[model samples]
Target: MSTSLQVGKILNNNNRITSGEIMGSSREGGGRGAEEDEFLLQIPEASAKVPKDAFHLAYIFYFTLGAGFLLPWNAFITAVDYFTYLYPEVSVDRVFAVTYMLVCLLFLLFIIGWAHKSSAYLRINIGLALFVLSLLIVPLTDLLYVKGTRGLYSGYYITVAAVALSGVADALVQGGVIGSAGELPKRYMQATVAGTAASGVLVSVMRIITKAIYPQTANGLRSSANLYFSVSIVVMVICLVCYNMADRLPVIQYYRDLKMQAMNEESKEKGPLSGSAWRSTLWDIVGRVKWFGFGIFLIYVVTLSIFPGYITEDVQSLLLKDWYPILLIAGYNVFDLVGKSLTAIYLVDNANVAVAACIARLLFYPLFLGCLHGPTFFRTEIPVTVLTCLLGLTNGYLTSVLMILAPKVVPLQCAETAGIVIVLFLILGLAVGSVVAWFWVI
Candidate 1:
């Protein structure tokens, strides 16, 4: 039995599963699904001759939007040198992780509850505007107040507030984009997921260029950090424009119309949408996809605890010096991109194996620890760098696989809410993992 089957069927009456959901998950990895030939009927959009994706514009837009949402986060974390210099007393990375993830998680819960009533369109537009504002905070603060000085503690608090603001923006954008993409085909979900890795890679590249061009001085770190936010701001503007225009695209609208049709049918059958009706439906959707959420939760709990925090703070290198963390981060980002993009070629259909892999990633904690406290050779740069890349690779692949699978488990109409629930679990994992990163001393 599949993991979903083993846990519990989504419906005993088989009313919830639709043809698109079946085909999306089943035809994966070239597996001929059970009795799929019998149910090879078309969903609403599929019933009509599917409109062309129009030079794959919708796909590219989604990919870019995926990349867009994470850029601010990457900017803040990758600017650790600047933040650390300004506030030497702080555990900069862990604190940022906690602040960002928790705020995002808390706001995400509210967004999920209010999601059916509000427009994701408005939420995303507001989010992109906030991203622009938050990305501007650090550089502007430094220019106006901090200068190149060290130990100005006021700057630290301002920076933390900016990080929290970015967290709120992330909750709005990530849930909306993922939820919207979930309403489409699985490949678009892969595009969105892969684009997330691309954001990491883009920031890493910026780190390389900035780290190389500037002299290794206090002034150099500040310049690099400002440059990071500057580029992020440009990307945010582009995303805002693109996302607003995305609603007009014929390909995107076709799917939106189909979802609306399904929703209307649902409303007609069940009467007007009341708060009570939504609450019951919300719980039902959550129950259907809880196992998938558990896997997503586990994935981030393992990843966030180790990455950026451990990669930047726990280890060191004589030759690489400050460059060591930059290079390690770059390597992880590259492999992460590779892993996320791999779903385009082949995906794991077996949920049992996918979830087990997430659990197996706990082994990374011991392996990374070995790099710090083990034998002389193991403590060297090569092993640590390799481990970091491996961490990124696993994190990317499993995240994409499970995200793509989660929405497919429910009926088409509930797919968007399922996606939002999965993202809530994702942020929840990040919040927990940030706390866990502190316990790394054990």
Candidate 2:
């Protein structure tokens, strides 16, 4: 049941998102012209005093949730070698990707439609539970059933089902977490977004560590795969505990009460958020944030198309031939973390420039193509490495910028919906990008 006071982060329109705190009475240009602003509005504090984040616990909780939600996909795909080794007939990685993305996109669509009727707290808890369940399936099944055997088609299907379950969990947690963060100040949003990049870096670093430590034999592969899911399960449990505790924090509750006050005032006048009224409001919020959503969409479409596919398959180095793609991926992830963190330092509040930068990312195509087709110098490791770093940097920063900016421009009441709608666009972009990667490079 929905709590009278919210159990997760939420948003209301306010001009007060500066330096990243959730509560304030002031608001920026909340109308259509918000898009035309010259710079982010001045700090303009609200009439009421803002409460502190209280030891940054709320901040840490949001960041952990962001990282936790993405870990399932990372765990599954990172352990791809074992899945393939166990069942050689099928393409394990591609199958898992298709199933997971499809399920996530579909569930996210359902969540967006019924967002007003549901609560972020319920969705997130259930999602986190599902994630733990999905992670357990892998290590447990391998231990009890597979027993280091090969050509186990039954085990393969079960693993794919777990991937699909994780996708459902992702759909539940990701939008709610981002939407929840949207209701708070900008720093929490920054933390949440940055944690996503941190997840990639964490997985990459762990993969490297496991590669260095483990033998290349079948037994070694099984052990490494088990480690990935075991560690992921521990993180998900931490996320669940941290997430439940978030709403109880003084800092988080302060903003929840603030948003509740606005909601109560609106409901008293409008006589509850009726279905038609909510649908109309949702459409308006969608209109307000569509351009920002487009920017997010383009960002993922570009990043995913080039990332694992181009880096993993198209390029090679004489010295780092086998390690080339691994190093390139690690570099991309570290720089992506750097880019997401940059937003906390200085956010580009102008919507026009943010969208334009996303469009500018189209240049990545030719530059990356040059790595394959252009002169030796352009096609070499240095150029590819530089371009890949640029790709991750642009992808991380622009995604963080758009995700943070979109809902803040909406009515305070509709901000959470706006954030979820933005996620709909993001998941769609990811799904499309995955498809495009399959057919890319002629």
Candidate 3:
């Protein structure tokens, strides 16, 4: 199933894939010996060549940075009940989603369209700082402003502002980390994805702990919110530190050097890119990986269609009651994490097969719709939970695979641009899915 395993199968078939071009030489000039050489080349290059043994550390930090960027967002989403309690009259959940997506989409367009050439490190650091501030704003407002005013409007508006800030932060970190990982080897991309899934797991665990330890009273809920946000803030600080340290690591520096060399070569070949050139670059990336882009777009479209709000609101378990949604969401996060991490062991490298699999995710829509309005058995908790796990697994694995492979399909200089384009497609999918999600209410 994995590309690595497929390599051996291809070798047994007499190295027909690359026509033995990968092989150096053989006794027959194209026999088993040459085939073995070709097989060796297909093995992923290890990051061990990174100077001073910092490669693994840098590699891990990329994962952490990825997880870190999504943690705050996850924490907020997981605390949906808390937000609902604070602002009973408002549709805080949908409001936050709308505001967050809008801000992230706008800022992402600006970054890629105009500031794509800027420093990723600088942007990410600022983003991390903003993320920390966003987390702090909620509690700080509750502590300083809410108690004095006793008006729900003040806290609600403050929470909305905090959500907006988180969106802006997401745009910075998502763009920077994804773009950076895209330029590096495939493994880093996997790491980043695994990290994102891990964030969900981490936040899910935190919620479970807080819910169990605290009483079910209003005070208990408030206390849990404080503790959760406090921990998220601390995690953001660590993420900031790890990101800066990773930048100085020898392995990261090696990639930086490679990127610089590629940029220098491109600059020499073509003078500075004008406005028209920027537009052309986008079209070029689209033309090169339209299917890959479509695959990514559909992947998120199907995923966002059912995740978070849909799962939390539309589904109910007569047995589990309050714990039903929580457990189902946790299951999704855990399996999604597993699916993403598995790619490190075995990647599906065939672009066509991968793309086709992504398109097949459309089956989820009808399947989920059936659960909502089909046979009585289909509405049961077990079936729904199982479906949720499969959805998460497929979403995580396919997204990582497409993202990891798409950029490599292009030239080195265009890889970063390609990465940005993929993110754009991903965001577009999110927007479309969010819109479609509203149909659940109708």
Candidate 4:
């Protein structure tokens, strides 16, 4: 009889075989996985033992931290009416696009070059503090100018400065949070993306509630804006606290310890990555997955082209009136959240399929245009809403898949760089799409 069969027979006929015979048969059957496989033997020794509560808290912290990072940016984008109220003479859309892009690029380059060395916790704390200060700058300036004896036009300059500051904060928090999460498990990465979608939904809901609660008059709009930013500031503070607490969680610490151990081993083997070595490592990652990068770029380009720029500004409904944009944006946010969350169920594993799906998003341009200039029915509320939801869903799902897949494709040491590079492509796509959004007027 074969080793496994003999072992089974020996166990069944307990009195017939000696213990020594059973042990010999069991060792011989180890390869068959009959309670003696090497893989099974290794699992208990290798796996990290994490507390259940710590694992759960880490998820919440990661998700909330991701949302907190993007919340202020969403606040700026969603509050189109308030900003237009502040600067009627200027094209706030184009101004915001250019300024935010410029600031993100500048600050992102700094992080990749030098600030990446800093602990993510420190960077996140600074970013959160700056965000609170940026949010406070606008309302406080408006209060001083309107209630006190300050000049009238000064509010415009202050608002511009505040927006620019918010953009800077975005770069810091975004890079730190994403880079830190990338070093953890894939689910944490998913949590971060889901959090981003949730932030958009949260801000959309906040705008809807505030708009309903307050009147449409200038003073009422100002009050609404104040309440929205105030709530956002509170959320940011909570995220900062939660992030620190998460660092102390058993599950998070386990991952951090493993990462450090691997990093140390790598340094000993390769003698710390010199500047050229780092460049070479990044270049190898690029060469291996250039298509993946392109797919991510396209995903963001198409997404940025439609969202906020188009959904917030171009689409309109006579019945819903001003509520049209708000509701549409909320729909997009909701679907996007669902799409990101769905990855927990099933993610597309094939790279070709994911890339092809991304390229298909080019269809969104023509489809959205049809909504703008097609037959009257195409321009109606239902079609626009459906297309907007599809747009958000695809954007959320594809971006999450690409971000999650890119790092795993790379070597362990290159994983962090892969995530950061993917983000850089994402930002590039946003900048390009924002510029393209201007052509909608033509």
Candidate 4 residue spans exceeding 4 A from truth: 1-44, 48-55, 146-153
lDDT of 2 by residue, 36-73 (tens): 22222322233223455667888889889888998889
Ten contiguous residues minimizing lDDT sum, candidate 1: 3-12
Residues 80-129, model 1: lDDT tens digits:
87788878888898889889999999999999899888899999999999
Question: Best-fitting candidate, measured by TM-score?
Answer: 1
In order of listing, the candidates' clash counts read: 0, 6, 0, 0
Error of 2 at 354 (Å): 0.7
RMSD of each: 5.2, 5.5, 7.3, 9.7
Give me the runs in candidate 3 sitting further than 4 Å from their true place.
1-55, 147-151
> On residues 160-225, what C-alpha lDDT tens digit does candidate 3 reach at each position?
999999999998888888878777766778888899999999988988888788887667777787
Which model scores highest in lDDT? 1
Error of 2 at 180 (Å): 0.8
Q: TM-score for each prediction? A: 0.91, 0.89, 0.87, 0.86
lDDT of 4 by residue, 228-342 (tens): 7888889989987988888888666655654454455456556777688766765776776577779988998788777777887788888999899889989999999998998
Compared with the true structure, model 3 gives a TM-score of 0.87
As a whole number from 0 to 100, the lDDT of residue 196 in candidate 1 is 96
Model 1 RMSD, rounded to 1 decimal: 5.2
Instruction: Name the Cα RMSD for model 2.
Output: 5.5
Better of 1 and 4 by lDDT: 1
Q: Which is the better candidate, 2 or 3, if ranked by TM-score?
A: 2
Candidate 2 clash figure, as a count:
6
